[model samples]
Each structure stands twice: as structure tokens, then as C-alpha cells.
Target: MKFQDLNTAEERIQLMEKLSETFLSRAGKNDEEGLFPFENIKELKESGYTSLTVPKRYGGKEISLSEFLCLQEKIAEGDGSTALSIGWHMGIIKSLGEKNNWEESVFKDLCEEVKKGALMNNCATEPQTGSPTRGGKPVTSARKEEGFWIINGRKSFTTMAPVLDYFNVSAVIEDSGEIGNFLIPRNSQGLEIDETWDSIAMRGTGSHDLFLKNVRVKEEALVELFQPGKKGAAGWLLHIPACYLGIAQAAQTYAINFAKDYSPNSISGAIIDLPNVQQKIGEMELELMRTRHFLYSVAKKWDEANDETRSMMQPELGAVKLAVTNAALTVVDLAMRVAGARSLSAKNPLQRYYRDVRAGLHNPPMDDMTIQALAKSAIK
Candidate 1:
């Protein structure tokens, strides 16, 4: 059955609750063992979570960004990798719908599969250039040949490569100087996964190298690369914030629970009773609340907003990403401080989350760049 056939958020929410609970319980084990959480992806695939963002026009549910953000936060609270990995799809498909770009026939077919819950990934990061922010400058190039474009390049950190049915891979179209996206089906000839994701955190995310050797795709399948401030294409600014906020909330909860239960031998009662400990908890909570309110409000506002708001939206989104990701890193650090020596143990959740949340600060449109842009926009 398709996503639209499901009827309401109530049905989808119920499905999410059950799957999220089970995945949450197993996420730690999977992370520790360096497992890809294929089981969680399978669980998501079986449910409607994979199709949750496809628009209503083509047999999809058309849920609001507020709802989408909530879903991601909840899942992330269970497992960071699971939430982050699936985000590429949620953010992209919805943005695509908003643009209404594809030919009706093409949209119909992709949306139909999306309706039944297929997953797509943004295969943008290449080994040569860290991210598109520096300029696509794709090391990969596609040459038009024999009624099809032949693509060739290497992409590292291709998250969800194992389970993705479709990939929105970017490659430069020679002669035209156009940076376009090609929808390459998974396991296409010459496409292979190089399982090299032995990271310190977010281990459950199957981010690996994608090897593309003379891969061919039809011209219509090539999605035009979007320039910043463009009308169509998934705006990178919008998606980054949700992931950061989710990580922040997770750190806050972990700290709260640890403080309540941990009775440091030096302290009288539980650590919760200590004045300094209480202050740390208070500060952490404050950070989490600020991020939550700001993020939720942005998602809500965007839901009812138009493109003319783009100018203002840039700073707003950048601020949230900066605030929430930094908060998540700080909150996790505080949790470690509160937990004391126990926090460093390999068994500790705080240890892993601390490392994981820090990645957000470096994820592109660097905080410095965003701050600079905000500063420049301020005087105007």
C-alpha cells in the first residue's frame, strides 16, 4: 500500500512509535559493533517512514515540516545515525515537490515508488572536494554519448549507499559547464560500495565510498544542479538544522537522566542534589529549550511562507544550525562532566554523543562563513 492510502498522521505516528522504540533499544549495540543498522532501515522500509515526505499530488502523504521535524527528533532520540541517514530523503523529496520540477510522467513514476516507500540519497560529497559549499567543482564528469550521458568519478561518505534504491549523484556536464544531478539506480554497472566507515561516532551510518566507472544514464534523469538562492532544488540550509536540533535534544535528555540517577560518591545524595551539578543541568536545559523553540518556530513559519522570504530565511536557518549544534556539543560535554570519570568509559552514551554532535559544527556553510554572512547582512 502507498503512503496516501494510509489516510492520516495518526496511523503513521503509531507506526513510528513502534519501530522507533525497537530501534532505540538496539542502536547502542549496533553502534558499538559497527553495524549499519540495516535492521532499522528494514523496519523503516516496512513502515511508511520511508515515504513520509513525498508530496500528496502523486499518491504521497504531504506532511508539514513541523511534523517532519518532530519525526526526525523522535527517531534521533532513539538513534542519531538512523535519523541523520534518512534525512537526505525527507528534505530532498519534499523540496523537490515544492519546486514541481520533473516532467509529470517522471514525477508520477518516482512518486509512485516513493509512495510505496523507496529511499533516495544525496550522493554529493566527493573525495577531491569536501562539500559543494566550496563550489561543486565535481571531480566527476559526465559526457554525452550515444543517447545517454556516461558518468565517472569517486564519491566518499555516500551515506545509505547500501539500502538506497536511487541516488541523486552530481557530476559536471562537460562543454556546457553545467553541474547536474543524475539519478543512478543502485547496483548499476560499475557502481560499488567501499565499506570504509570506521568512524568514532555515528557508526551505524553506512557512509562509504562510491566508485562510479563509466556509468551511463538517460538525459531526462539528470537533475539540474541548483545554485544557492534558487527557486527549485532542496535548500541545504533548511535540512542541516533538523539534524543539529535532534542531536541537541538527545544530549539534553541523556544529561538529565544521568544526573538524576548518578550518586557520585563524593556528593551526599544523588548528583542531582549538588548545587553545581544542578546549575550545569539548568544551563543544559536552557540551551536545549532555546534551540527547540527557535527550530520549531522556523519550521512552522516556513510551512506557511513563500520564496520571497528567502533572504530572511538564510540568517534564521544559519542561526539555528549554529545554536543547536553547539548546544548539543556543550550539553554532551556537561553530561560527561556531571558523570565524571564514568563518562569516558567506552560503555557510556555521553562519550559517543559528544564526538558525534561536534561534527555538526564543521558540516558546511561553516559557522564562520555563516557568521560572516549574517554580519554582512546585518548592516544592510
Candidate 2:
């Protein structure tokens, strides 16, 4: 069902819940085989979920930030890999729509493509440069040749590489010695995916390496220019924490279910009655509640803020990501404690949830960096 067809946020969320149930069923097989969830993505595109963040002027629902994160959390509950993978596309579309940084025609064209199921993600991380948030210059170089720009570089952590229709790559302009983002179509002459992803966590994300061997694009393909790590406040990044939070919620559900049904000969009732188990469950509920409030409150603020206000919210945004991601880790840990050793069984979803939740620590706005930003903000 098209997200636009739904008149209310609740209806849209219900649609996602229905889609997520199917994604949940295949999550285990995809995680076990390290297979990209192409089918899940296809289903999302068919449901018009992928284009929900496109601007209303572009005929999209343009859901509020709170609604976007809520939907993202729901998707993650079903499959963290698919949620994380698709989150990039959703957030990028929202960010671009909000920023209006690119050429009007160009962005409009891209939005049209998105409405037709086209997917794209930024590829910035490189082996030598590490995380792009660390202020490292991209080794990927772009040089102007005739009327086109030739780009050559390799990018790591290119999530959803398997089905991406477009790659927005960061590269240093050789002539101007400046960083720029180039929008390279998947059919670019020399663009290729290396299939090198092998991380133990988020195994189904397909975050493989991207290689550009003298790929050429029109000069207009240069979409954005900026200093590394200096981009303004990005509320869209909330999708990261939303994803982990959803995984934690899944873990909590599994743990509670396990607790209620698991009765041992040593106990007259289920272990959920035990004070220690009750304590863990209570702690999980507390953290989930706290983080959800923190996440959605900030999302609401972002939705209501003007550009000037939003630009100054970097510290708050970072805090939300830092708080929610870490809390999600805690929640999952407590859930695992509730389940005891059985949580680590290869067949158990908790094991998958545990691994997937940890991946959030490595996503953009790392804890250390966020703390430092908070300190800077406080001091300034």
C-alpha cells in the first residue's frame, strides 16, 4: 500500500507493521547466510515506503521526523539489517529535501527516481581514511576531463550496494583541492562492488566495498561540497539509534516471552516471578521507555525547529544518538541476562539481536565523538 494512501500516521505505521512481519520471518535465514535482503527491499519499494521521505512538493508523504524514526524502529524490530540498510536511503532523502543543497532540477530528478524505487546511499568511508566523521580527506580523487568529471577511488562500508541504483561518492577535487560529492549512477562505466563485507554484526546489510576505476559523470553530477566532519546538525542520523532501539525492543519481547513460559523443577512458577529476573525485565522496560522518550522528543523538536534553530542542535542530536544507542546495548544485555545462556545459542534470535545492536556503536556519531561534541558545546 502507498504510504500516501494512508491518511494518518497510525495507518502508515500499521502498514509498516504488516510489512515488517514478513521481513521478520526471513531475517534469520538472511542473517545466517549473510545474504542481502533484496526481497525485503523490493517489498518496501513496492509498498512506497522508500519514497515517503521525499518532499511533499515532490508528491511524497514527507512524514515528520518523529514518524520517520518510529517507522524505522518498527522496521528494525522485524530485521535490523534491513532497517539499517534502508535507513540510509530514507534519511538521505529527508536530509536532502530539508537542506535543498543540490541543484533543484537534479534533486527533483533524483526524487522522481526514488518514487520509482531507485535507491542511493553515500559512500565516503575508505580503508586509509577510516570513518568519514574523523575529518580524514578522501583518497578518492575527482579530476575534470572535458565536459565530464573522472572519479577514481575505493569506498568501504557502502551499505546496500547489491541493489543501489545510485552511489553518492565523496571525492577530493584534484584541480580545486576540495571535497565534493558526486552522484554516480549504478550503470557508470567503471563502477563496481567488491562484495567484501564480512562483519559478524549486521551481516545482511551488504555493506561491501565500492570501486570506481575512472568512472565518468557529467560535471553537473557534483552534488555537494563540504569539509569532512563539519556538516551541520543532522537529525536524520536518528535512524541509527532508532534501529538499535528496535532491536533492543525485539530482545525485550523475546526475553519476556521466554521468562513467562520457562518454569523449572526448582521453582513453583515461571522464572519471571523470581526477583532477579523481574529486576532485569524492569530495568529493560525502564531503559526502553527512557530512550524512546529521548529519541522521539528530539525528533519532534527537529520537526518543529527552523533552519537556524536546527543548525545549533548538534549537541542535542548527538546526545540522543549516544544515549539511545548505549541504552539499547544495555537493554539487550539485560534481556540476554533474563534468557541466560540460551540467549547465545546460534539458533536464538537474541544472539542475532545482540550482535546487531552492537553495530550501532560503530555507526556515525560515535560515542567518544558525541561526548566530545557535548563537551565542546557546553564549554562554548
Candidate 3:
């Protein structure tokens, strides 16, 4: 099941499909217990999926943006939580390879680790400051002391904290009053996970609190310095929409199956034959069709764009995320309507899909912010 061994896109997709089928079987138990899907992640790593995004120079596949989103959507169809938790790592690796913003030696080292199945995610959200996307400077503080940086503060929404090998943390530099992203190893001294994540949705993400008490690292740990919310266009963030789209697809499938099999005494045939159910199913399919075009078209453009062209696509990127995610929510809602009361049952997968789809609304590039940006873009 090595990704490198697959010669064609169909072959790669078949591998993910096989893997996702297994993930779907375990998804219910993991969601019920709010447990991290460690076994699912292990299978992905063992299948060589974890290293797919590392650059070819680093002995990895470095799949295109469109392909990456396609695979992410497949994973989400099985389990949104697992897809999201792994998407961060995949997208970050792809972005790092494309931008090469980090020092060459440092990025090379991280790529090597990624090739070895290491996982990482950015830790920027905080309880006091909120999402970094809103231009909130991190309350976490980093100080230069004797040629080393001392970091101290707690970060919220540290997703995949239990299994991440590295955390790219954002902190305000004490000496310069500037923000910096520090790449800290999981085993670093004075670093710990607080296990505080208790969200009703996306429970399998394991987005616990990260505590750094006098954590020290060499100066090279300072990876990038930038102002919050002003970073350049990130096409990688499309993974967010891809995840929700997959959940919507799963809900649609479940509703259709339920309709086809459940026949009421009043009806001569299955409920799927009823005009109302057919209308709802039609609407769901339309939403999926529209969103898929929006998502993949934008992804295709990003994959074909040069650095200069891509730099000016922030508005388009945000629009794709906003449009696709909202459409996904609509698709899921329509599916639930088709399923009726049974969709609400705890035993039904639609219930989990409903909650997980809602979580996408709260992901990065919030709906309000995206609308505001779009307004400004139109005016300009």
C-alpha cells in the first residue's frame, strides 16, 4: 500500500478508498467515546499516506493541490475528525515545500522527519487572544536568553496534540514586540499537553491545550516572523472545505440508502419514490455538484499558478472555503430532512455528520470574515 508504489491516480485513490472503508467502521465507537483515532492514523502512516505531501526532492510524492484535496475529501467521507486532524499535517507539509520560507537546512530536516512518518501542526489559537486569523497576537511569550529562546504560555486548539511529533507555535517576542513562529519538538523540556479539548463536535481531533513553561530551544527554532492575519494567500487552507464536503457526501449516501430500504404502510413503495424525498435528494446532489466544481476549479488554478499569480489569490481562496463549507452545511441539512427523525438517533451516522459539518463553520477563515473580505475586494 505504499503511495510510491502506486503508478496512477486511480491506483492511489483505490488505496485511500480501501483505507477509508476501514476507518468508517471504527468511526462510531471513536465518536461515542470522544477518543482519538490513533489506530486510523497508524494505518495511514503504515500505508505511506502520511508522507505523500513531502517534496519529491525529499523522497516523497509531493502531490498537486487538486489531488491532495481529492484524497482529503475521501478520508473525510470515512471520518471528518480523522480527515481534519491529518489534513493540517498534509497541508502544512505541502505549504512548506512550496514556500521554502524556513531556512533550507531546517526545512530539510523537517522534511526528512515527515518522510519518516512524523506529524506536526501549527499551534496559534489561544483562550485569551482567540483565533490567529482575527489578527490576535498570541499571549504566549518568547524571549531570547543566552543565545536560546525561552517560551512560556498556553495555546488552545492544539489539534492532534497527543500524536504530533512537532508543534509550530506562535508567540510574541518579548524583546522586539513582534510575533514569531517557533518550531518546538514534542519531547522538549517543560512542554506538556493539558488534555482540555471537550468540543461536542470533531471530538476525535484531540485539540487539547498546549502548555509551555520555560521551554528553551536554540535560535534556529525561530522559523518565521510575521503579523497575524496578514500572511500571504494560503491555498493549503482549502483542505478545510474538502473535509466538510466529504461529510456531506457521507450524509447524502446514508439518507439515500435509508430512503430506498424503509417503506411505510401508507406508501406502495419505498420512501425514496415519494416526491418530497426525491426533491430533497435532488437538492443535496445539486449542492454537492456546485461545491465540488467551486472547490476543484480553484484548486486547479492554484496548482497551475506561478508564485506571483498565487500571491494575489487570497480573496479567491477565502471565497472557495466560504462557498464550499456553507454548501456542505446545506447538503447535510437536506440529507437530514430526507431522513426525518431517524437522522437524530445517536446510533445513526447522520447525527455525527450533522455535528461534524457544523464544526466547519468555526474553522479558520470564519464566514463573517470571509464575507467582509469579499465586500472589501468588490469595493476595491
The candidate maximizing lDDT is 2
What lDDT does the true structure give each of the candidates? 0.75, 0.95, 0.93
Candidate 3: Cα lDDT at 112: 89
- Give me the displacement of residue 181 in model 2, in angstroms: 0.2
Q: What TM-score do all the candidates reach, one by one?
A: 0.92, 0.99, 0.99
Per-residue lDDT value at 293 in model 3? 95
Model 1, CA-based lDDT: 0.75
**Segments in model 1 whose C-alpha atoms lie over 4 Å from true places:** 1-18, 227-237, 264-268
| Comparing 1 and 3 on lDDT, the stronger one | 3
- Tens-digit lDDT track of model 1 for 1-380: 43345667666555566666787788778878888888888777767677777787776777888778777776777777888888778877887787666666776787788767778887888877776665647778889998898889988888887788888888888878777788888867888889988877678788888888998888787866655223222243455666666666666677778888877588777878888888888888888888888878887787877776743676667777787777788777877788888878888777767777766776655688669768987988
* Cα lDDT of model 2 by residue, 202-226, tens digit: 9999999999999999989999999
**Clash count, candidate 1:** 0
TM-score of decoy 2? 0.99
The superposed Cα distance between candidate 2 and the true structure at residue 341, in angstroms, equals 1.1
Candidate 1 residue pairs in backbone clash = none
Look at candidate 3 and give me any clashing residue pairs: none
State the displacement of the C-alpha of residue 157, model 2, in Å, after optimal TM-score superposition: 0.1
